[model samples]
Target: MHDDMKNTTPDSHKKKRIVIGVSALLVAILAAGGAVAIYQHSASAQLAEAKSTCAQAADRLRVAQNKYSALINGDEYKSAVAVTDKQVEDGRVVTTLAKDSGDETPTMVACNVEDKTALERNTGLIDKNTTWYETHAKTIDADVKNVVKARDAKTLKDTQTALGRKITDAKKLYDASKDKVKDDKTRDALKKQMDAAGKLKDGKDVKKIKDAQAGLEKAMKTVNDSVKAKQDADKKAAEEKARQEAEAQAAAAAAQAQAQQQYVAPQQSYTPTYTVPQQSYTPAYTAPAAPQQSAPQYSAPAAPAQPATPSTPSTGGNTGSGPISGGHGCGSLCTSAPTDTYVR
Candidate 1:
């Protein structure tokens, strides 16, 4: 019986050793599985935390990008273009505030992606944009302020130049209107306005300069109207004087012509008018019965006394007709009247 017990002891020891080895193998497998499960849980938590942080950053970035775009595309930015010259004069420059300062551009992503690599990349882009906008926000606002200042400066300068020209022109008009206006008051008003215009150069205010220009133009209009009125009156008076002088000249000419006609008539009717007709009548009367027209024509100056002289020359005591003698032919119509009456 002792020898049999000794033979089974080795087999028992071997069996116990095999059982301990199997238990150790099972414990190792269970520990490995627990480690893997813990690792997966920790990794998932990390990814969720990263996603939350990235999404919050994305929200901030979106707000920043909206602000940037509004500033760059706003009316202030557009108005800056018109004030280029003024900006240069004032030593102000406007440039791009940010590379992403454009239309409503959102962030790269909202961090809603599941892939780790994608989340990292999009988060980086959003962070970069947000940082850029934050860094230049003040500078962008400053640029807008500068543009406004430049616009005001340009307006002031242009107004000054235009108003200065008007002042100069008004002064010229005032000078010209010195002694030509109908009333001295009109020139006085122009002078007052011109004097006020000179003060415009000293002031920087646009409203003051514009007001001066308006006043000067109004005064100039008054002066011009007054001068025109005076000129018209002078012209009308001159025309009236000229018309009166012309009428007087015409009347004098008519009177002179009438006097000339009266004097000429008196000269024409002196004594020759009656004497000439009688001379012609005497010659014609004796020409019908006797051929003594030549003797009558020659004796026409003494025709009134020729009849008695010819009758006395006849030898007969009663004389019916005159004798035809070579010395005195056709005695009644002889060339000369007898000096004595029929000498014995």
Candidate 2:
């Protein structure tokens, strides 16, 4: 029994050791294969992640390019041109941040390259380009802001100057028109509008200033209308006065003409009237003279009928149509010679 026990234990122990050794070798081989697979998967994943990141950066750069394109079309570009000889200077802030010397465009690195080192290098370049785009955008944005601010300030100043001039003109018009306006209220309203415009002169709100200008102009219109109405009324009154004076003068002239005509005396022709005077004479008888010169018995013609004394002219007597011949002063009226019928 002792011999059988020693022989049987040796074989079994040696087989057992061999089997354990084989199992350990198989486990080691399996572990080595799993480690290789894991390493390969990790490497591929890293490359894919890098590609994705690089593509995203490229996309971001495209977006930036679009934004920059739009930005340059804005007013900042115009101001840059105007201030810098019609083009952006190379040394300017935004211009300096443009594409690098080797880069054809401002675009970032692409993800097409598969080498890890190249991908990493491209990633760095993408980051740099991103910074450049951001900086350029920011610089241009600031320039735009400053330009717009300056332009607005200038516009405000010009508007204020114009408004001030308008206010002055309005004031002058008010001074001249205050008393002549038909209504006191219109002139007062104009003054109020001018004052309001003056208050708004320092403001930056263009709309409000323009509104004030409109108000002032409207108020001026009212004042002007009132003044024109008064002027028209005064002109009409003056014309009426002139017409009245002319009519009065004409009437006076007509009255003077009528009085002159009425006061004129009628011319009259005078007719001479003669009145006969009756006289009685006493007869003187003389003794006949015995001795006389022989042939001429000429007695002095009876002392010609003594000339009839002139009597006062009769105002009521009618003038005879025919002329009368009388003893005295009958030469012009008598057609026959005197007859000597009785001698003294």
lDDT tens digits by residue: candidate 2, 123-228: 8788788777766767766766554555556667777888898899899998998579899999889889998999999998988888898898899898899999
- The per-residue C-alpha lDDT of model 2 at residue 206 equals 81
Q: Pick by TM-score: which candidate is best?
A: 1
TM-score of each: 0.58, 0.51
Q: What does the lDDT come to for candidate 2?
A: 0.69
In Å, residue 209's CA in model 1 sits off its true spot by 2.1
Question: Clashes in model 2: which pairs?
Answer: none
Supply every candidate's count of residue pairs whose N, Cα or C atoms clash at under 3 angstroms.
0, 0
Off by over 4 Å in 2: 1-46, 62-109, 112-125, 203-206, 247-344
lDDT of 1 by residue, 69-149 (tens): 787678976676445543444543444322223324334556878866777777788898798776565566776676677
Residue 168 CA displacement from its true place in model 2, Å: 2.9
Q: Give lDDT per model, in order.
A: 0.72, 0.69
What's the CA RMSD of model 2 in angstroms?
16.5
Off by over 4 Å in 1: 1-41, 84-110, 134-151, 154-158, 161-165, 247-344
lDDT at 261, model 2: 72
